[model samples]
Target: MGTGYEPLEVLKPVADDIWIVDGPEIRFYGMPFSTRMTVVRLSGGGLWIHSPIKLSLALKARIAALGQVKALIAPSVIHYAYLTDWKHAFPEAEAWIAPGVERRAERHGIPLEFDHYLAGANPDWAADFDWLVVRGSKTVAEAVFHHRASRTLILTDLIENFEKDKKPWWMWPILRATGIAAPNGSMPRDMRMTFRGNEDLLREDIERMIDWDPKRVIVAHGRWFEDNGAAELKRAFGWLLDG
Candidate 1:
């Protein structure tokens, strides 16, 4: 099935040297969730892919036209489903994963070979991106990124803005309760619970993202913010930022 942002597997430019590809929806907990991937062409002419979706020959060709695929990012434990396919296609690309992903992949019986664990500074793409691991969550840790050139903040699941019209009627209440409904979506409640005692840490990270002054915010699942990204960050994290 198509995620409203159709023409799947095709590159849709978000800014200079940056593109987002909407992918097919995946079932999670019996609910269908949309997926997206971001592609960035670094200054040195190499492509950096984040939260990759299902790979296709057409998609691969399109991406190759942009630049060589240098890095494949699994930004969160739950977002690495298609990494293996991409890895097979681009044998030379480095697979950089977030914390806990290795264990999660192994548990799911998905054999994945990762080249680097995302943490601290990496000279490879540091010149074009600023990133940080969102700490304090007991369940999951996400590596958030900000593309320096386009001022675009790339997020996996930190904040979801699923549009009501795009989802089934049965998911309306669930989405509202989870606080992920579009135009007002924030961090999901269950994920927020994981940061109970260490909200301060999450708050600090949010502040740092706001400091980036991103012009647009690209989320993996939902309608992303195209403008006033700093304000959107504050609004999305209002639960913690307010307190």
Candidate 2:
């Protein structure tokens, strides 16, 4: 039997105004998987959190120092593990979720009371952000959000970030075989799966994202991309429209 490799225990800041905290001392069949979290402080007193993992007292204190957390947002149901804890920590703030995530939460036995999510419906919340519901894909009902001021595209599981050279031995095969891992961690497979039968709809969403001209792309499973982020996105998702 093989002794599984240990989980990564480092948190690195990969972009301006962004920090990625990898999981510590954990693994799946010797493959190390890390969770990514992003903290975006919007104009004025608005704060948007994307896929927050566990919030220890120390982590909570670190976050509080940034500013008041105006809203806690989760991109999908699977990413809500720390929502309750963070909501308890920041009870004054509102909770936001993606489409069909609430039902999935209930099924997964996770307690969640989200104030809003894109459920084949429109959002009537804050005005500093715009959200897109990638429709026609029945694989998953979730919405992706873009922040205007920061020009940041917040995503979870929509992209992968494994560095081709740095990936742990076990992960390389799985990621490459799945076509979701690239030299820069591309989600070819998942992106393909995400679009499924709704290729045109996915294209429209990408065009919408292009309109925003975001400066950065944040993914929950991989490194955050900056510096010609739009180009990175074009290269990453190019496989979809091109093929």
- Please tell me which predicted candidate would have the highest TM-score against the true structure: 1
Task: Provide the lDDT at 180 for model 2.
Answer: 58
The Cα error of candidate 1 at residue 10, in Å, is 0.9
lDDT of each: 0.91, 0.66
lDDT of 1 by residue, 1-243 (tens): 357888788899999999999998899889999999999998987899999998888998988787789999999998998898998888889999999999999898998877888876485887888899999999899999999999999998999999988888899999999999999988999999999999999999999999999999999999999999999999999889999
Which is the leading candidate under lDDT? 1
True-structure lDDT of candidate 1: 0.91
TM-score of each: 0.97, 0.82
Superposed by TM-score, candidate 2 places the C-alpha of residue 89 at a distance from the truth, in angstroms, of 1.1
* Candidate 1 residue pairs that clash: none
Candidate 2 Cα misplacement greater than 4 A, ranges:
1-31, 119-126, 164-166, 188-191
Model 1 residue 137 distance off true place after TM-score fit, in angstroms: 0.5
